[model samples]
Target: MSLIMRPATEADIDRLVDVYFSAFKENPINIRVFPESSPQSRAFWKKNLEGDLKEDYVRFQVMETVDEPKTIAAFAVWNAPQKATNPMPPMPPLSAWPSDGEVDVAAEFFYDIERQHKRFMGPLEGAPEGSQQRPHWYLELIATHRDFQGRGAAGALLRYGEQQADAAGVPCYLDATPDGRPVYTSKGHGFREVESRLYQGGAYEHVFMIRDPRTSA
Candidate 1:
């Protein structure tokens, strides 16, 4: 199926939210963190998604069939590196979670993500060894509608960010779920596993991977 990529807009929020929830409906971490899907929970996602769209450093893109009545097949959220002088705002606070959501688990998960992000993506200048201190792109989120899996939609979305990072002579970063690790680390992709962590007492796990810029022939 032919697909086209485009920047997501505020008008797409309703469909985007539905696609996001549908794509991760069975994800272990999401299942644990957001066991129930309420209007409040959806509201939180909508608000944060809007905030992401407005951020200069954030790139939110959606993929759709090229045919008429284009149907959104997948979406990805990327965070472009910013200068230290103007740091991006932190992730939404725990209080921002819905009343029925697993606040503690969600908080812990986000905390770990932030810690690893800051540690691995350090200053872009005069940095230390073994640190990717460069202006890189971070894959904050990527998902495809269940019915759309295996159609290359997700890979296309990922490659869009990879292309941007390559043009800037920087790397790309992402935390992959077990099911996604193989694809991300596969040859041609070149994402190396840098760290792995388990949450909910091993019920859920994510592997952090980094891909250096690829030079054109």
Candidate 2:
């Protein structure tokens, strides 16, 4: 089936949410490894995506079925330079967050992977929430619907983001998952062989990878 890529609109968020949740459902490693399961993770991401989409700082792209308007294939986005973004809810005692989707879904995500791999996913550094302005593009999220896996939707989304970066004359960067590292490397993104890493829960290591769209664009 043919797919069309375009700027994601508010009308597409529901489908985007469905695609994301479906992808996560299809990847149990992501579920058991992540901290957002138990019924509320879906709602958590929905809140994040919706709030981010409403922000001028966040940009998103989605691929949809050309033949079936009801279907969404995948979506990718960059976010930062936000204005007073959502704050993390208070955490429970004696926990970085929670193994469950309690204080923060994102942190739960970190816990999921950290607990699974026994390594940090990336450097534990970020500008204070909404306080730092990102000069380049950040790949905040990307997901291909499980139904559409092996169909090149991820590559399409990557190319689309790079095109945007090229048009803006900026580079694109992302904190790559172990599963995503080879994929991004195949597309010419390079890892910061140095400090762009994390040491979480002890030995878990998450590395960062970036693409200079100026070259590949």
C-alpha TM-scores of all predictions: 0.92, 0.67
- The deviation in Å at residue 40 for candidate 1 is 1.6
User: What does candidate 2 score on TM?
Assistant: 0.67
Q: How well does model 1 score by local distance difference test? A: 0.83
- Which of the numbered candidates is closest to the native, going by highest lDDT? 1
Q: What ranges in model 1 sit over 4 Å off?
A: 124-133
Among all candidates shown, the one with the greatest TM-score: 1
Tens digits of lDDT, candidate 1, 78-152: 998765554434778878887687788888787788778777776656655444345779999898988899999
lDDT minimum window of 10 residues, candidate 1: 125-134
lDDT tens digits, residues 1-217, model 2?
Answer: 8888888887777688778777767343355434445445555556667777786767788888899454789998765322324332121232432256434434544544333321222222574554323345667779988889888888888876676777776656666556677777773544342224444343344546556646432
Q: Which stretches of candidate 2 lie over 4 Å from their true place?
A: 26-39, 80-134, 187-205, 215-217
